[model samples]
Target: MDTDALSPLLSALRDAVLDGDARGAASATERALGQGVDPQRLVDGALIPAMDEAGRRFENGEFFVPELLVSARALKASQAIVTPLLAQRGGVVARGRVAIGTVKGDMHDIGKNLVVALLQGGGFDVVDLGTDVPPTRFVSAVTNDRVDIVGLSALLTTTMLQMKATLKAMETAGVRGSVKVIVGGAPVTQRFADEIGADGYADNAAAALALARRLMASGA
Candidate 1:
């Protein structure tokens, strides 16, 4: 399909997903597939771009929690439909493997989820450990999954400390240098990342993608 023709379908899919209309989103996804839409395009062109807009709108105060939730719901719905197709196409090879999670005591997951979406869009194989993940869990994932990078997230200042401790644990476990570390969240800053010996830090999801790619390239 031409870009022009695909734009509206893509938009509709975004709307449907945001509306939490799973059936409608699924219908739209099927239609796009029938029209020979590339599965990657559906994710990168449609879903990820829409979520990026949502994130922008959120940062600008044009979108509130309800709006963000709706948009995320929609994107996830569309993802459900398209991801399987992408999987069938020999599964997208990640730029690198990453194990990601919210540090212990920090239950916030919105930012983590957004990062995961953006990472997936950027072609990373992400093993998400979810919210309130312990330091040991992160280490185990790194060891078991052989991930190229480890991303630690914390939304609260109190919990942000967990990231540092987690890094320390990695060192004690003798796997600190085995993988690059990236950290982020509302309370995190580039300075803090440096203080924690993190290889990189990003303020938001888009920047996270760029940083992840750069880290992978430099490490490789």
Candidate 2:
């Protein structure tokens, strides 16, 4: 597809996602592909950029939960189509490997999901451990997955403490130095991350991506 024709379709896909029209987003994505648009173009030009806008809006308070959720859902819908293409192209070559999880006792997933999307968009192979993950599971993922980075999420103040304990467990397992550790949540802060010996801390999903890239580049 010519850039002119592709640009409008890509914009449409972004609008559909931002408008919370999941079906429209899916249809638009498929239509773009059918029109000979590059799958990578769809991802890089539309979905990732749309999510970046959503993240910015969220940080600026221009978007609320409903808005962000709609955008995320739309991105997921588009990803459903693009992921297979990427896999066929050799699994969307990643910059590095990462393991992510919501710390033990925290069943929340929204923050974790956003982090995953941001990381994947930034070209990382991320293994999501889902919610309520124990410290040992994190250690095992690091050891078995040979991940370069570990990310922990905890939305509740009580569960945020688990992030530190998980770090301690990683230390005990002698894998703390093997992988960089990052922590975030509604209650988490850079100070807390520093106190707990985290390699980095992000205030939001975009910052998370930037931090992950920086850490990985530094050979952390």
Candidate 3:
């Protein structure tokens, strides 16, 4: 394995992530790591760029939400291997802590799962509350986990209304002001997020990570 011939390995990793092929991405990551390619190099060179490109395609209507979610999952598969190695090298940087869930009555997990992968890829410790998460569970997770951001997801118009209920529950539980709430999902809109008093709104997982970082940076 000529370390000088890293281009093929790097290209394979990038293409795997872009194709949303989890096993392929992970296999490529393992080969890269075994060949002594810098883990940070693979992350910066392959994972981030793949996700960024996915975001661009999503925004341009060349790719849909599900495709982006699949790509995020693939990035996460490779990220899992790269992260621990980066940590051992004392090179891993955590952006923030996040607790995210699809609101109660919304059983959609793909979007929330995508956000989970993206958050971890962005170097945040994420506490995933899973789909159809109740308001009590959201509050409990935030209070127990000490998360920097709380994210609500809803894939249906009816389920999006649960975001408001969840917010109210958090306010009643005295946790609303303790953390920033960001909302997203198919039916979610910026107007709805603002009306519900959410701190931020993201149309997709990549944007969710950016929003979480900004919310945390704002001291929320």
Candidate 4:
């Protein structure tokens, strides 16, 4: 575990993720763990940076959905190894808990799925509610899962109204103030988010991760 030896393994893991080499990423993680590298270090130093780079590439249009998903799969490969060790040692501290879903009446989930992967890579414990999710289901996630943030997604103008309805459901459940709400989708806008009283909005997966981090930092 000397500095020189540690540096290369970390680099290998990072490169594997950025290159979308899931098998290599997993093998690197295993080798690093066997070499006595701290699991948390692997996560914070290699995995996080790799995902951040992937997100950057995505935002710059240098990476598409396929590329992003591949990178996420690589991260997942590493995390599969690291997570259990962290759990055993009580070393992993999740940034936050998030519940994400497409609002009711909108079956589109491409954007939501992308955001879900990025959020997971960003170190948030995400509960993916899939597409055409009911507002009541979101409310249940907030109350039962004790999630810190709720992400509502809609690809249609018609379905966007469901986002507002979802918010209203949270209000009715008296948990509106307890959790921060973020909205996004192809047709979603800042003005629409403002009108719906969302805490934040993001146009893409990278922005969603950034917005989630900001919301956590601001205690929103």
Clash counts per candidate, in order, are 2, 0, 0, 0
What TM-score does each of the candidates earn?
0.65, 0.63, 0.62, 0.60
What does candidate 4's lDDT look like per residue over 1-220, in tens digits? 7889899999999999999999999999999989899877887679878877887898899999899888888888887777655445322578899999999998766457667766876788889999899999999999999999999999788999999999999999999999999999978999999998999999977789899999999986
lDDT of 3 by residue, 42-83 (tens): 866777678668877988999898898788788878877876
Runs in model 1 lying further than 4 Å from the true structure: 49-71, 87-97, 105-126, 143-146, 153-162, 183-192, 201-220
Show where candidate 4 strays beyond 4 Å.
Answer: 1-91
TM-score of 4: 0.60
lDDT of 2 by residue, 52-88 (tens): 7887898899999889887778777877787656545
- Candidate 3 Cα misplacement greater than 4 A, ranges: 1-91
Local error of candidate 1 at residue 7 (angstroms): 1.7
Q: Top model by lDDT, which number?
A: 4
lDDT of 1 at 25: 76
TM-score, structure 1 vs. true: 0.65
What residue runs in model 2 are displaced by over 4 Å at the alpha carbon?
1-91
The candidate scoring highest on TM-score is 1
Q: Write the per-residue lDDT of candidate 1 for residues 1-220, one digit (tens) a residue.
A: 7889999888877777656576787788889889888876776666666666777787899889888776666666667676555444333676888899999988777567767867877788889999999999999987899999999999888999999999999999999889999999978999999998999999877788899999888973
Least accurate stretch of 10 residues (summed lDDT) in model 1? 82-91
RMSD versus native structure for model 4: 7.0
